[model samples]
Target: MEDNDQRLQRIKKLETLRQLGVQPYGTRFEVKDRAGDLIRLHGRKSKETLEQERIECTLAGRIVALRRFGKAAFAVLQDGADRLQVYLKKDLLGEQTYRICEELDLGDWIGVTGRLFRTKTNEFTVEVRSLTFLSKALRPLPEKWHGLTDVETRYRQRYVDLIANPSVHEIFITRSRIIAAIRSFLIERGFLEVETPMMHPIPGGATAKPFVTHHNALGMDLYLRIAPELYLKRLIVGGFPRVFEINRNFRNEGISTIHNPEFTMLEFYVAFADYTDLMGLTEELFVRLGREVLGRTVIDYQGRQIDLTPPWRRWSYHQAILEVNKLDESVLRDRSSALAAAKQLGVEVDPNAPLAAVLNEMFEETVEPHLQQPTFITDYPIELSPLARRKDSDPTLTDRFELYIAGREIANAFSELNDPLDQRRRFEAQASQRVAGDEEAHLVDEDFLRALEYGMPPTAGEGIGIDRLVMLFTNQASIRDVVLFPQLKPEK
Candidate 1:
């Protein structure tokens, strides 16, 4: 009811301004300067210096705050980066312009031409010589909704959240810088950035259920890509020595603090390189990002300090599971024994799950939460990494590594499995599981297999979760905080 009253009052003001032939919703005002830049350039200047300089400028921003005192007034104009005090006097703006300014309210967009000056109180400010009413806010901003304390409102109405909180703006600014830094770093290293199709005939890149869409013209279903792996690898077969893509991936998965259904990934493939090579490259990229974005090699995430310094702890996957759970190696030998071990340790697992799946469950339950520092869990089981090359030392384990930090998986890398025959067999195994009620199973993409048959070189590929990486750098606890618009349930 109070909101409706405010709306009505603002509407009346709009009508009155129209009567006066003053354009309340205005056209362009030449904005040659911004509040933040003005402050940055001249905040320290003395009153005498500012008066002597007589710096005149045009500015525009939302009227975040207003204080009217009869014929004189003060307001805070919030531009993109910062806010500045604006003073309006009846004698200066004239009666008609002052009346027009009187109609203005909080959240209205206004433009002004002013000279930089120091207030009697010694604060730097803008003294308005003229005013241009750019826009009028019908409803006033909520007084209580000033920050991210109201989670649902903050996520749902991000515009208001951003307006109310300066810190929110900084996070996204840092996000942009991080992405730019990554792009610049990769380009400097001769990695060619490329684009791949988001829709796939068969989702085979990763073991995850996909969001299916239909092409009415073709009368066929296409899946939103779960990963860009196969398409990027196809570029490898096509002879691109180094390729990278920073793009979106969709997965039909549950949401959590760390998980989002639609997210960004930085996937790259390097020719003539193995998974071991990618480990060093991954560490270098992360450490560089830490220094560039956060200005430090060690960062505090959710109260725990994580070191992004090089030579991060590396442990084989089987070793991590055994050491973390204190379980005998026999439990990982077969499904039956693994299930028995999981039951005894109070770790839940499906009785029919494969041996490697059982081991993964144990690892997630025991090992993951303990990986607070940046660590690489390497040599994953062949069953778990269908697209990775088998280690020469052990046919059972693939040359794969998953980097974990702050108890969350940040990147996945592996040596490319170029043998079409091995890939087909793995796909067939996954297909059987899909038929047997596992929806998150890979489908045999014959086209991808055909591309591999054309001969891909010895290459290593990796995907770093950009959202999670941003979360770490910005110290955001939730993926939703990092994502501009996270997947959310329908608003009631």
Candidate 2:
């Protein structure tokens, strides 16, 4: 609901403008220069130099501030990322034009034809020769001192937040730059960017509860993809050696500072590459992104200086758990012992969970938060990784690694499991877990298995959470801070 007094005043102003034969809302105004460019080009010029040069410019922007003294007024106009001051005089604009200006309010969009000049305070300004109204704002902006301080309101009404806060604007700008850098890095490495389906008959790429929908015509249930991994792998089987997709993924999961149901991910695969090779590539990509985006190989994230230099520390899953908790090695080698240790450490675990799952729970609860620096936890238990190949030396562990930085997992990669019989066994295990009431277990994707039967080459694939990457680079604490429009409950 609008304040009646303010709305009445603006409506009266609109009617008055109509009576004077002026269209308060304009169609098109030719803008020859932007306010920022004008300031950048001539801001350093001396008053005398500007006066002698007599530079003329036409610019358009939203009126952000206004101050009036009878027939003279000063207003600040913001265009793009820059702001410029405008000086309006009743004598220069004539009585009719000055009256139109008097009706203007802050938040109105307008165009002005003016000459560059410097005020006595040495502030660059535009001396307006004429003005045209582009649009009107009936309601006033939020108070300047308080600003849009409510967190929920800021996320709900992002446009107002952008207008009230300049820092928010820069975060989104950096987000675009980060994505562009990723594309440039991949394209230069001969990776072909491709699109994959967002809806799938079965969600198999990742272990996550999926958002389900019904297809009316087919009378079958479909799931919004939790990852593009399955489709991208199918492409590899079809003979596209190197491919990548930067797209959205949907998961039916709890919401938190670090979790959003719908989010962006970057999934890439390379034939003839292994998990170790991807680790090196991941290091190069991170170093390049840090240097290009922040101009440094080390960045301050949430007050911790995280170095992006390559050769990040590598540790096995069990080794990382031991480093963090000092648990005896025997405790992790058997399900009953791991479950007992997990109970002693106050980490929750299912009574019937396998040894690998119990150890995983302990590691996630104890070790993940302490991984402040970039590190890789490699050689996961075979039960924990359904799609990764088993290591040659240790068949119980799979050739997989997860990159952790700033106390959170940023990337997960593994050598693809190409053996059809092995993949069938893994899928069967996952199906059993699903039937045993694990909603997050992967479904058996027969189509993916069929594709694998055609014989895919030895390959490696990785998925990176783009939102978390943006948070790391932008120094944001919450995933919502980086996502432009995060999921939120309806306002009461």
Candidate 3:
């Protein structure tokens, strides 16, 4: 039914109720107990024997269902956790109060003062003495079979979704628990939680397109941070031994089941640590979180069984590409060899792109989905990881690892680059790449270089995608499902 039509009808009903000396909207009703707690408290007793005790309650909620039988009636009232049946009789409530009960609609919120009892069918119920209208719900809730199913409407009217589908509330509850557990885990390990600026003049943390806005007061263009990597590292430069930030990070990118334009990220840095230490920490934290929050080391997502137990399998980028495509190590030396192999394997390659980028594309297309279990794909190509410290044995590869589960990247960590000269050169190369039309390229932040020159301690930092992690824990398929309000296209 149209909302306006229902509202008008309710207004007319209110006038009728007033004429009968009944208030259609009430102010307050003090409920002595919650539905669930009361049920648990009297669990052992039979409903009939319990109701005979003459228990009293001032319960209030929306009337979910109503059945009328001439002078008597039974209505189901839904409070927060559970629903209870309330019986209203003409003998107990006089004619005027009985009339109020008869005129009450299914969606109306009412407060009932009653003594608990049982019916002939032995269903525990409240024999209401008097009823008061708490609020009038003019619009009818959607039918159970066809509740608010449209994605756009569900996001736009999130309150309706939360009301109609209890599971959505559970998902968000679990999401909050996951974040809380992470904080507790870190704090127990002596890490201080911190916050960094969301707006930046030079977004040098990661290679991603940034959402730009003009700051009128500052009279400069400002960009939302895609990652808090640089600023957190500057903390290390200033001698904060351990710090972490769990906050929103905005990225101007394509929206998909796995990617959201704006989402929560947990990025933390630890001085005197490397990717190896961070990897161990990541494994420990995830396993602990899964067990503590979910009460299991294993969870099923879609059709795959994911085990979040620690000591996740680790593979180097070179080895991953070789194993997935059945190419030997000898064939992966340079651009020419990798390009020839790429063509032979039907994998797309960018001729002008760096060798590492091409290999990454191949791995993403061919190998990522096979990583259904918790796995750390380590030793990424140095070119693709400009800010990461290179491996001592292999200058071409960096000490970086991406944690993957259910074939999606969940966390990324690296031994941070601390050499000022080397960082300057990488930034210059990134600037050149930007000039050559890569909008996602990094910017050369002179301030970050100055911090590096000030001699920041050896540090390792990692970013965990909070939305994706929540999705995994909640068994939600789309990133939008976890996000309360995902961005959508403008309605035309």
- lDDT of candidates 1 onward, in order: 0.90, 0.91, 0.86
For residue 392, model 1's alpha carbon misses the true position, in angstroms, by 0.7
Better of 1 and 3 by lDDT: 1
Q: Pick the candidate with the highest TM-score.
A: 1
Q: How many residue pairs collide in each prediction?
A: 0, 0, 0
RMSD of 2: 1.8
**TM-score, model 3 to reference:** 0.91
Off by over 4 Å in 1: 334-336
Worst 10 residues of 2 by lDDT: 139-148
TM-score of 2: 0.96
122: Cα error in model 2, Å: 1.9
State, as a TM-score between 0 and 1, how close model 1 is to the true structure. 0.97
Q: Across residues 24-122, which tens digit of lDDT does each residue of candidate 2 receive? A: 888999999998788779999999999999999999988888999999999999786578999999999999999999888888889999999999898
lDDT tens digits, residue span 1-492, model 3: 486777788778878888888767777688776666666765456775675676777878878788999999999887763678889999999998898887777778888888776678877788889888777766666665125687777877776777666568778888999999999999999998889999999986888999999999989999998888899999899989999999898899998888889999999999999999998899889888889889998998987779887778999878988988888776567887877888888888888777777777778888898889999999998888999999999898899999989999999999999999999999999999999999999889999999999998889999999999999988889998999988888876
